[model samples]
Target: MEFSAADPGTVRPGGRTARVRAAVLRAAGDTLAERGFAHLDLADIARRAEVGRTTVYRRWGTVTGLVADLLADMAEQSLPRTETGSLLGDLKANARLVQRTLADPRQGALFKAVIAAATCESKTAAALHRFYDTRVKEWAPCVQQAVDRGEVPAGTDVHEVIRAVSAPLYYRLLTCGDGLDEAAADRAAEAAATAARAGVYVLG
Candidate 1:
């Protein structure tokens, strides 16, 4: 069966299939982090996953397809939005989560590899965009709730505010010059909260 970008979730398998897919994804993530997308080989993935080469080829079709499905799975498994009753609290929670993920050796390397691939591959870029979009949408309601509570002005660009909370954390991760520590997360949360209160993200 051919998997489309529009229906990545539909590629789910049952029992053995599910286990194989999970193994392949884990192997793919490790390979991508270690060797990058250009060097990714289905044979290597099959060997690492302990699945048959033919099965990998038949299921994923191409590297892009596999990456897309892996990203879709990540989206499905991502943590739900934080609702802490205040914009500052919610943003801090979000930033802290990002900091923790980026600080992890395996996850940080995997993200860097995926981002590097997305820069040159259109398919990977699209998948990356979808992943961030899913994450942003999930957290945007916190900003909206703040508006409703009169903590921030109405007509705030909730999505933009949410994005602002993570932008600096991602910047640090991609640059590799600094650590995305809890202090940095706190600063990001403070900056985004300050900006929102100052009408930086408010829409006229």
Candidate 2:
């Protein structure tokens, strides 16, 4: 079914399929945020999504499968990398994005719940890692652009540098010892920029 965003009921071959997939993803995200991975069940997701349990089982086969697909969808929907013509600006954009998401009460709790699940569940952990990999890949180009502009070393590990920019924010969120605020975001951006310029992120 063809599922066009413009058509409400195109009745194409993939129309219902796309709608059901979107519904399941939304339900999965809601359940993950609300109850964590332990309580996540395909049946519960089906009910929440208003899709049939048999359909969910037939398609996903397992909760882990559903989670994996959900992560993929999230990665697709994530914002693209920013290009502000400077390492500091690009890093600040990345940091601000992390801070905005981490600082929101609901989003913060949701991330904590998901990360906690990832720690014990191998499948969930892998999915979580892939999710970050996708996001990092999306933003890595910004760092590369900075390198092209001579803002950082040409041989700098762009992906690693971008990942470093968000590492401390995630650390603070998971630890619950400090707030992930604008000031914290600024600090992270500055530190990552300075370190990258100093060859800290360059490979031998």
**For this target, which candidate reaches the highest lDDT against the unseen true structure?**
1
- TM-scores of the models, in the order given: 0.90, 0.89
Name model 2 segments beyond 4 Å from true.
1-14
The Cα error of candidate 2 at residue 204, in Å, is 0.9
lDDT of 2 by residue, 64-117 (tens): 888878766666666666678888998898898888777766556666777888
Clash tally, candidates in order = 0, 5
lDDT of 1 by residue, 1-204 (tens): 001121123345668878888889888877876777888888999999899999999999899999987887877667777788988999998988888877777677777888999999999999988888888888888888999999998889999998898889889988873777999998999999999999999887
lDDT of 2 at 49: 88
Q: Global lDDT for candidate 2? A: 0.79
What is the Å distance of residue 113 in model 2 from its true position?
Answer: 2.2
The per-model lDDT (C-alpha) reads: 0.82, 0.79
